[model samples]
Target: MSNSARILIVDVEPHIRRLLHGTLTRADYRVTEAGSARQAMAEIEANAPDVVLLDLGLPDRDGLELLPLIQQKSKAAVLIVSARDATDEKVAALDLGAIDYVTKPFDTEELLARVRVALRSRLVADGGRASIEAGDVSIDLVQRRIHKKGEEVHLTPKEFAVVAELARFPGRVITHDKLLAAVWPRDYERHIEYLRVIVRNIRQKLEDDATVPAIIVNELGVGYRLMGVAG
Candidate 1:
């Protein structure tokens, strides 16, 4: 909705870059173009764009390999726009910190919608938001507080840390290793049971029905997901 958002389009094809530049400029967004991973990184370093429309097939390096590097460079949200539509590739990209993914030949409206979501979330993170409203609960990331339907829900410091980590990346899957490393700073490999116990306690306290969890969803052996990030 905001016309002031800046977008960087990274693709190997010249025509694709030209087409995206026209489409985004017509949509009233400031646009930048890069034809290779090296160029993309250069643009990112010189000035970080608000959102990056990245193509996985790059001439210099694979987009998958460059995704994390981009994250390391800036706080910009990455929306993958590649022709690789395989489920595994999508999962891999999201797991690597991509805000969202769109396959090539993507619908104009749908792609724009996803971009809007990414921009909105960036606004939330950048506006000094020390809290999040998820469903009936409010998470105060600053104070590490949780209130359910106007009532305080107490939790241990460790429990709060786990929930906060997942909340940090809404609508994105956080792999087991990433979560464990974040929460269990010292050693996390042998502490899945500890994480599980804490997650169970969190669910019992916050979830309406712990048996059928809605706020915190488990990704089988991967990690937990914080649902209802809309607050």
Candidate 2:
């Protein structure tokens, strides 16, 4: 875990900001704190952190509005750390291009894990280090390639698209509809099997221990996500 991976912690609470600052700093992650949307935008413009931990309730403007602006300015991954755990809120954040969301009173370890996964995928996007290797598996989104140990692995066009899409976002739980639309077309949004079969294949190829997959994981009825990476 390199301190080079920077994260912006946006929270209205002073204690929350302080706790995150201390926790992240001790874990060797470069962290920037912002208490308002205005300050968050400013910090994002100046430093361009790799990932943003955003709170929906901001003092000035709605944090959700800043999502598009943040994405437009920089390719930083935004994770909404809000107390709003409603289904609509989660879906809205995901649809608006946020990578993930964590409600208040969340587990610190889970939050850090999501941050790590988001940073890893962002690293791939930034072309810093494109390939991710874990155990015997490797995923290369740039080259549209995958390999197990030293051997090359082949996949169909649709299969590759699904794998690439999920792996690109790492810990982000992309919904089944979202995956279908991105891979197939807007019309195939209801085809759940399209995601399921491809996911099964990807797991079989990448997971050294298929029974306990480390590369890609399921989110039950929600969607699939690529997990287990460092921030």
The top-ranked prediction according to TM-score is 2
List of clashing residue pairs for candidate 1: 133-231, 134-231
Candidate 2 — which pairs collide?
116-231
The per-prediction CA RMSD against the true structure, in angstroms, equals 12.5, 13.5
lDDT on C-alpha atoms for all candidate structures = 0.81, 0.78
Location of the lowest summed lDDT over 10 successive residues in candidate 2:
126-135
- TM-scores, one per candidate: 0.54, 0.55
What's the CA error at residue 166 for candidate 2, in Å?
Answer: 23
What would the per-residue lDDT of candidate 2 be over residues 42-87, giving only the tens digit for each residue? 9987776778999999999888787888898777889898989899
* Model 1 lDDT, full chain set: 0.81
lDDT of 1 at 69: 98
